[model samples]
Target: MIVTSYGKPAVVILSVEESERLKELDRRVLRLDEMDDAQLHEMIAAEIPPELRYRIEDIPETP
Candidate 1:
């Protein structure tokens, strides 16, 4: 759960499984920082399911 104060996010509550997943993603992000752009994108795509993956051209950089 996300905790909000004064209409801004303050904290998050996560199950043990969710926390573990986030920790793993953090490690992946740290590793990604060392990869070249092409290799980084390839690894991200490979980890995500094909159907769930964003189309290269359809990805958004900003809200």
Candidate 2:
């Protein structure tokens, strides 16, 4: 875990394996967002390897 100088919780640091897994999940989500519901459902049915997935909504949005 990363912390701020003021004794506040900041960003977290993940292990390399977990980080890579989440990165792959992020790529999948970005691609899935453009698809129709059925396609998304089919893809999900195909089973994406689940892992720790999270969104940092506090960050600025980017294309």
Candidate 3:
């Protein structure tokens, strides 16, 4: 359920189990954010096998 203020959702209500699951997910994201750049890159690369990766290049700015 959602509680609203000024027609905008202000708070959410969830079952105990759902709340616990969301809390765990939040903790996991926090841990990932704390990882160093190299560690994070390694983890991402490990998830996607070498066959599927592609390089991302910046596009030149258009005047």
Model 3: C-alpha RMSD to truth? Answer: 10.0
Tens-digit lDDT track for model 1 on 1-63?
A: 889999999999999999999899987674656789998787767766678877779986863
User: Looking at model 3, which ten-residue stretch has the lowest summed lDDT?
Assistant: 54-63
User: What's the lDDT for candidate 3?
Assistant: 0.82
Q: What is the lDDT of candidate 2?
A: 0.76
TM-score of 2: 0.46
- Estimate candidate 1's alpha-carbon lDDT, on a 0 to 1 scale: 0.82
Cα RMSD for candidate 2? Answer: 10.6
- lDDT by residue (1-63, candidate 2, tens digit) is 575667886778889999999999987674656899999788778853556444687568865
How many angstroms is residue 49 displaced in model 3 relative to the true structure, after the best TM-score fit? 11
Cα lDDT of all candidates, in order? Answer: 0.82, 0.76, 0.82
Candidate 3, residue 1: lDDT: 88
Q: Per-candidate TM vs. native?
A: 0.46, 0.46, 0.46
Candidate 2 positional error at 32, Å? 7.1
Per-residue lDDT tens digits for candidate 3, residues 1-63, read 889999999999999999999899987774776799998887877766667765665455555
How many residue pairs collide in each prediction? 0, 0, 0
- Return the lDDT, model 3, position 36: 97
Native-to-model Cα distance after best TM-score fit, residue 37 in candidate 2, in Å? 4.9
